[model samples]
Target: TQLLEQSPQFLSIQEGENLTVYCNSSSVFSSLQWYRQEPGEGPVLLVTVVTGGEVKKLKRLTFQFGDARKDSSLHITAAQPGDTGLYLCAGADGNKLVFGAGTILRVKS
Candidate 1:
């Protein structure tokens, strides 16, 4: 069975601080995606990494896939209160997706 593990299940930081979250897995995946979600709403896809060592950035957020395709990371720079939300990593297994437990981040203004 494929499984994804996310680190630092919860985080609280002041605005302008930076943080990095990680996702790891023993099983290889064809693709991996990152998502951010606010309370009472569905997660929104942030980025997808398909190639090993690929990196994608969205404004102050950066996503990187491990060279071996078994891990990924997300880094945020100068966080704002609006950045507070749940961050998730999902690995593609054929047509199904294996999701990490998710990391909750709260940025206080």
Candidate 2:
């Protein structure tokens, strides 16, 4: 079985702060996907990294997949209050998925 572990269960910051979140596992997966969800809405796909050591960017956010395909990270630059949401990391192996507990981020203005 594969499991994803996320760190810094919660984060609170003022506007324009930068934050980095981490997801880790001991087993390798075929691909990794990141999602960000807001209140009253389902998670929306942020990015998917399939290759080891791959990096993807979305505006002010950066995502990286580990060299061993067992870990990933999300970095946000100059975060805004509108960035408040829950961030999740998921591992895809074949058709199955292993999800992390999640990281809740709150940016105050």
Candidate 3:
């Protein structure tokens, strides 16, 4: 089984600051997905990157897939308090999908 390792595990930053979280794996994935989960809600899909060296942006958030498709990163620019949540990375290869431990972000106003 393949697993994703995410770091630094937890992040606390002031509003308007920029931050980056990472997800890495020893195995390459066909596609990678990023999700955000709130207090009482299920994780919501943020973005999916399928091609190597691909980059996608959603407003203040940016997602990037490594050239080998074994790593991914999420960058938040001028993060707001609303960005505080659990960030998860999931990788899919054929019929299997694996998720990282997740990074909890706390943005203070």
Show model 2 residue runs off by greater than 4 Å: none
Lowest-sum lDDT 10-residue window in model 1: 92-101
lDDT of each: 0.96, 0.95, 0.96
- On a 0 to 100 scale, what is the lDDT of residue 49 in model 1? 96
Q: After superposition, how far is residue 106 of candidate 1 from its true place, in Å?
A: 0.3
Off by over 4 Å in 1: none
- TM-scores, one per candidate: 0.98, 0.97, 0.97
Model 2 local distance difference test score:
0.95
Using TM-score as the yardstick, the better of models 1 and 2 is: 1
Local accuracy of candidate 3 as per-residue lDDT tens digits, 47-99? 99999999999999999999999999999999999999999999997966699
For residues 1-109, what per-residue lDDT tens digits would candidate 1 score against the true structure?
8889999999999999999999999989999999999999999999999999999999999999999999999999999999999999999998888999999999999
